[model samples]
Target: MSKVVLVTGGSSGIGKSICDHLSGQGFIVYGTSRNPDSLNTPELPYTLLKLDVVDEENAKQVVKSIVDREGKIDVLINNAGVGITGPVEETPNSEIQKAFNTNFFGPINLMKAAMPYMRDQRKGLIINITSIAGYMGLPYRGIYCATKGALALVSESMQLEAHEFGIDICNLAPGDFNTNIASGRYHAPILEDSAYSRNYEQVLYVVNKQMDDAEDPAQMGIVVEKIIRKKNRKMHYRVGAFMEKFSIRLKQILPDKVFNKLLLNHYKL
Candidate 1:
């Protein structure tokens, strides 16, 4: 029997690539978008389900609907996330809350909804698409980093807890991918008199340039496919650009002052 795979935020970018790649591998893939009817991506070969991960009730309904139709969900990929960029002090609580709602809590809700089914089956895979930013704070994107960092921590605990149930939870952190995330990031208002206004623009400019030069999203799809085929997968996997993938290792070995300086230099701070 084919495995039933669910991928959120599948209308485009990495999610779309993953869905297409998995479907091509013969898995029964179902991708979700807030408005499936509005998506015109005919080249994507997978079932389209309506889902808004930020809504707890809606998330449960979508999971239940998938279970009803597919009988079991073998894999759940939490690829849905949003980006927010700005100085932490200037970023409004509301904007932070919105980013958390979509990036952190959203994946948590979907996992909560799907775990029972996974536990019952005694075998499943849960992949949370985090970011290399989760490993450290970034200038003008601290909040975004915080959200992914929180999810990465939770995923660690989840791996231990779910192991007894024959379920695997992995945090897949990618550095920078050629996706539409840059254009979609929420920017905190920079008032004319704001102290960080000038710095914010420069930081945002660098961030955008890095994103523009990011690796292809298809690379993530290939990595995910390999992960899915593994009998015993690692709890954490880091993909993407060379420095971004190596940064995690560097952080562990380098002194705080040195690592911090390198980070600042990379972002031109």
Candidate 2:
């Protein structure tokens, strides 16, 4: 039987590319989005479902439905997430709530729902798509980074526990990929007229500029496909050219204060 794989956030950007690649690789791929109707393309190689991972009940139901049809779940990719930028102090409670719900809680809920079937089968792969920001914090991205960092830590602990059930877990930390995430970036809500307003404007400027200058999404999609195909997958896979290398080496070669100062200066924070 073909291995059944479920990819959350599979409608666009990196998710769409991964879906396309996996379907081509002969997996019984199921891609999901909150609104499947928004995609105006012909039918894809894989099945597409309406999944809002943030909703715990919906997530559980979707996983059960997939298991009912497929008999076994082989791969679960927790790729659904949103980006929220701004200082922690200035960012609204609602925006922070949404960020944690989408980025952190969504994956946790899906993983909780998928584990039962995978444990029963005694074979599965769980890939959590995180960011380099998960490892290294950046100015104006405190909330987003915190969510990814939490994911990375959770996946780490999950790997140890899942292995007992014959399940393999990995975290994919991509530096920067060209994605609609930039175009779809949600501005942090400005709740009041205060000192935070000026800082918020600065953050908006930096984030918007970076979004305008991101890499192609297809490239990272290909990398994700490669990771899935590997027989001995590492605990973490960092994709992207220069950014990954620089992030790794900078931590080794530069002083902490020096590197942070450079980052602050570069972003004009």
Candidate 3:
């Protein structure tokens, strides 16, 4: 039987690419977005389902509906995420909540919702779209990084525990993808003359200046599709330019002080 694949946040960017890649691979693809009308899928072989991952009931209902129609879900890609950038102190509590809800809890809820069907079949693949931020902390992205860091741990624990059920969880760490995700970032609540104002300005300046230089999201789709199709997969896939590899390796090999120096110099801190 052809595999049934579902991608959350599939209306655009990396998620859309994943949906297209899997559909091309002959999987019956279904996609979910909070705003279903955001997608224009006249050409893609995908069915779009309305889902707001932060809503537990809504998340579960989407999974249940898919299972009801397909009889099984062979793959679930938790690709929905949002980026909120600012100095940690200046970012509002509501913004922090929004970040965690979409980035961390959203994926977790989806996993919980889909687990029953996967556990019943004793097989499944769960792919998480994490970031290099999870591996190493970045200045001004404290909340955003925290969400991905938590997700990294979540993915790790899930991999260890879910293997017995014949399930696999992979955390994909992509650096600087050329996606509208950055352009689509929710701006931090602005406060002029605040102590953190300068830092916030500096953060957004750095982010805005570099976002256009990020890698293409389609390549992310290709990498993910390969992992999904593989019989055995690694726990993590680190991707991006020379800078990304160097960053990940430096964080792994260098002492904190040394790595911090490089990071500061890289962003001219």
Cα error, residue 76 of model 1, in Å, equals 0.2
lDDT (10s digit) by residue, model 3, range 120-191: 999999999899888888888888889998999999999999999999999998888767797678777557
Expressed as tens digits, the lDDT of each residue in 171-221 for candidate 1 is 999988888886688988777898888878888778778876889899888
TM-score of 3: 0.94
Q: Report, for every candidate in turn, its global Cα lDDT versus the true structure.
A: 0.91, 0.85, 0.87
Q: List the residue pairs that clash in candidate 1.
A: none
| Alpha-carbon deviation at 12 in model 3, angstroms | 0.7
Per-residue error (Å), model 1, residue 204: 1.0
True lDDT of residue 169, candidate 3: 95
Worst 10 residues of 1 by lDDT: 38-47
Candidate 2's residue-wise lDDT over 86-197, tens digit each?
7687778988889889998999999999998999998889999999888878877888889999999999999998899988899998777778786555666665776677
Candidate 1: how large is its RMSD?
A: 1.1
What is the Å distance of residue 242 in model 1 from its true position? 0.9
Error of 2 at 204 (Å): 3.4
Per-residue error (Å), model 3, residue 132: 0.9
For candidate 2, the lDDT comes to: 0.85
